[model samples]
Target chain A: MGLMETFFNLDVLHSSALALLEGLKLTITLGLTSLVTSFAAGLILVLGRLYGPMPIRVIAIAFIDIFRAIPLLVLLVLVYYALPFVGINFSPFWAAVTALSLVASAYAAECFRAGIEAVAIGQFEAAKALGFSWTDMMKDVVLPQALRLVIPPSTGIGISLIKDTALASVVAMPDLLKQALQAQAFYANPSPLIGAALLYLIILLPLVRIVSSIEERQKRAAGR
Target chain B: MTHQKATQPFIKITDLQKFYGQFQALHDINLAVEKGQILALIGPSGSGKSTLVRCINLLEQFQAGTIEVDGIEVKEGRNLNKVRAEVGMVFQQFNLFPHMTALKNVAIAPVRVRGISWEEAEKKALALLERVGLSQHAHKRPSQLSGGQQQRVAIARALAMEPEVLLFDEPTSALDPEMVGEVLDVIQKVAETGVTMLIVTHEMSFARRVSNRVIFMEQGRIIEDTPPEEFFGCGPKTDRAQLFIRSVLQGHPDAGLTAPLQVLED
Candidate 1:
């Protein structure tokens, strides 16, 4: 086959596009649930670090550091494979969700911590001066500012979570890549994988652009 | 919580001492302010003016001695929430939350801290924003405003707490040369309402014009506390005070009332 003929088969592309589209629901579902669960967990970690007791903060910190150090593939395997031996079995879907959330929250914690630390010392002083209770200080003053700052990097993490859904296929969750694999196996052609890669790019590129534009607008607003 | 309106000085600092890793930041600092006095603190950087102001509300803890605000003595386990609530501070950085609109910034303290309804606090915030000449920009974020406008919003935020005393730490020091006047005007208006103020500022002329007394500090100790008239105008008074006066007079030859006051730092 000619190089163009191999890389650009319309039949392969069409079949892959249809199959990947069929898998789209699982891909998006995993992405969104992982993003949310991990963000909630990350919030818990951040708050634990900020206001939790010293030992609790230490444990949370270790969790962040440890999860960040492990490979996501290795971590996914552990969740799906190792835990079942201990009778803490997670179904494939839960295993992927659990593993991705673990990885995502580690990054999310770092992002959130940076955002919180960016708030000035004077703010806490002012919060105290305003008669805010400790809870009120976090809810009213610190969290609002910190959350706004986290938006851009956070969206980047969201994009990463979406991309990471491909790892789910390794655990047999049958997401886009799996469908692409099945299509390629049936047709004895590998071009559908390239088409699948193209589809991933399609999903990611615009989200990155949107985050960049939001970042730009924030900078302009900050300048005023 | 119930007491007669103070016949005694509202804030009293008696032999207060603070140490920063064995370096003394405060040295037997004894000071007092009547309920309505506007005291201006002037010093070189690191002279502990900001530290002293912070100690008043226990924002910075002192190692030994007492700070009394509204007749309550500083104690480690004491409920300081009331004292803190009744004293407001404006920072050198303005410190308005950049993501928050001016109205939201001003309203947050009252609503969250005092448990006031948001609607009521926002109504008051709008009125206070107008007082500081920022009503038109209430919906804009702090990052959208000039330094002067942001500082005014900060003052309005402080005022929203209805503090018995307002503390300013070099409030206009970070401002552009042209923008200092508007913030100082808002502060001046706040002072006129008999709000006790302990201000740390480099604006000698503004200090002279607005403060009832000027305090000069060096090396964490007060060198002189004099009416602005005596503090700024002479030589050979004390070698240090004389040196300070010359520096001020030479640097700001037209600093006092004689020059048409432009709010510029120059």
Candidate 2:
């Protein structure tokens, strides 16, 4: 009933350590898979929005609008539960990933589009004048510069997606949050949730620092 | 300097017309640029000098008429890459690729378009940079270089393609007054290489010194197309050309205030 006994109970912490570790593994796997898939999907959407013919552009726009408008939890529930009635049932993990990646791609596409637009018109004109085809121009000139420009924001999206992975617990994925809640119920202690929170901080703190430093460098570069 | 025969036109434009929405930007423009000729286009702002030069490279498509560079007509549906590679354009803004080094800026086109080896492209690019007196700044990015140096690097980039003709759309117009001389000096050196060039410039003296021919445009029309000496000297043919010459001379403090008086006297 002391502060240390209540908040930092080593006995409870030790008991929940194994469950927390398993949850961490799921969190990492989900994060990495979702991140890669979302980034790829986002780039495609960005390209479609920027350079596609009319039909593709309209499709990209519609997809982005719908995914971004829905909450990730609602998306997860719909994918995991509602899709079973449509004969397209998915596992909890896959449902979580699909929802997360879809929403993340929508946001990431907007970030990437902004980055591309931030590049001056002259760069495109210069690339064209230098006899670069559209593909070469985008690959060699525009994308490199634009990706550099959007690093800070893209990292922000990454951190956000990382946190949003916790929402996968709603679909019974046995991810970090779900495992932590289960451990808390079994031990009748809150320490597992705190441990999970600490684990998240440990993983994300370096990334947060990296993003800030990158932003600082970008600011100084802009000033120059 | 030997001039190409009058019969051989390297660049020929006939009945060129351009419009932006309802406003006419160029009207009934006809011009011919012989090979190796340094032609200076001088005109007041809003006079279509830039538009006409841009049309030569098909940067701005004309509403009507044809532009032929080395007898390759510029029009819709043509593969412009080949023709564009043959004609290098330097913008007034010195649009250097900010991400690349000076050497890379000059080397990229050859490597990307000409399918040359990187080493060969860099070798040619370095020689061009040296020609422009920017060899020391080869590793520097465009942002690190001064405006004049960036423009010089742009000229080197344009030259690295070994284009048959170079287009200058107000090359010196974006430079600081002091830096203008350095860019013009490099341009003067480029002129001596016998490459045909069309320069839209406001530097009347520099144009007089470098141009074989001078074109005067007004209200989207060419008012005078004559030798530089005649265009800059004893008389400008039309009253508008005369007024322009007087105004240009009068604006230059170096003109000693008597030059405009002489034109007025005439």
Candidate 3:
């Protein structure tokens, strides 16, 4: 068979489309769930590391360091396969989410820390002089500015998280990559895998473009 | 108003000592500022003038001293927000919230900290912007405004809190020469409202014109404290102050010193 017929077979793609669609749904669900959990957890981790009491700060630092150092695939396997030995069981879906969130949260925390530290010291003093409580200052002044500063990097993390959802296939969550592999075995064609790659590109390319545009806009704002 | 003696100082500091690591920033400072008095603090760089003003509002912690603002003593672990609410500070950098417009910058503290409604806060903020002659520019962000306008907005933001005392820490030192006049003009108007003020400034002429009293500091101590007329007229009482004033006059030809040679001879 020619390359197009073997690798990009329209007949195979049409036949396997439904299965790929099912996988796409699960992939999106896992990616979005992990993205949200990681972002929220990242914010908490950063706040604790920066402002919490000594014990909390130490725990936050340790968590970030450990998760960031460990390979995500190893952590995923351990969470799925090893945790049951200790009687802590999670479903394949949850295991993937837990592993992804742990690692992504660490990266997100570092991104947030960088954004927060970039804020001028004068901003803190200004908020304090205005009688804002520490919480109010963080919520109303510091975080808002930091959020603006962090969008590009944080979205970069989100894109990576979305791409990393493919790793969920190893846990038998039947995400896009898993579905494509199954389709390839059933029909003896690589078309479904190409289709899955196309779907990922469709979702992530716009996000990549958005990050660059935001960065450009921020640069222009700074220049002004 | 609570019944208090007319002789009581509105803000008082006694034996205040501040340190940055092992280096002393302020030494044995004692000052009592009456209500409605505008005092200008002037000194050479590193003379602790900014440090002294900053301590009044508890922005800088002193190693040993007492600071009393409106009868409340400032110290560690106290609810300093209440004291800060009563004392407004305008920084040399302006420090306006870059993300907020001028009106929002003026209104945020009142709405968030003072518990005023947003409508009321915005109304007061607009009025303050008008007072600062920036009412039309209220919708503009700090970056969109010139240095003078940003500083005016900052002054308005501080005034919106309705503090009894205002601290200006070299408020115009960061502005261009042309922009300085507009900001100082707003501050001069703020002074007319009878809020007690302490200004750290290098503008000798403005201090002489705007302040009832002038303080000179050298090496973490107040070298001279006298009425502006006495301090600027007969020159400073101390030899160091005399030499400092002479050098300042020669450095800035536009300090409103009519005769540099005459002051140098003194």
True contacts kept of each: 0.72, 0.52, 0.83
lDDT to native, each model: 0.84, 0.88, 0.91
- Model 1 chain A poorest ten-residue lDDT run: A3-12
Q: Write the per-residue lDDT of candidate 2 for residues A1-224, one digit (tens) a residue.
A: 88776667789989989999999999999998999999999999999998999999999999999999998889999999999998998898899889999999999999999999998887887777777777888988999999999998998999999999999999888988899999999988788889999999999999999999999998997797
Per-residue CA lDDT of model 3 for A35-111, tens digit only, reads: 99999999999999999999999999999999999999999999999999999999999999999999999999999
Best-to-worst TM-score order: 3, 2, 1
Q: Candidate 1 DockQ score?
A: 0.57
How do all models score by TM-score?
A: 0.87, 0.93, 0.95
RMSD of 3: 2.7
**lDDT for B173 (candidate 2):** 75
Best candidate, lDDT-wise? 3
How do the residues B175-207 of candidate 2 rate in per-residue lDDT, one tens digit apiece? Answer: 887798899999999999999999998778888
lDDT of 3 at A102: 99
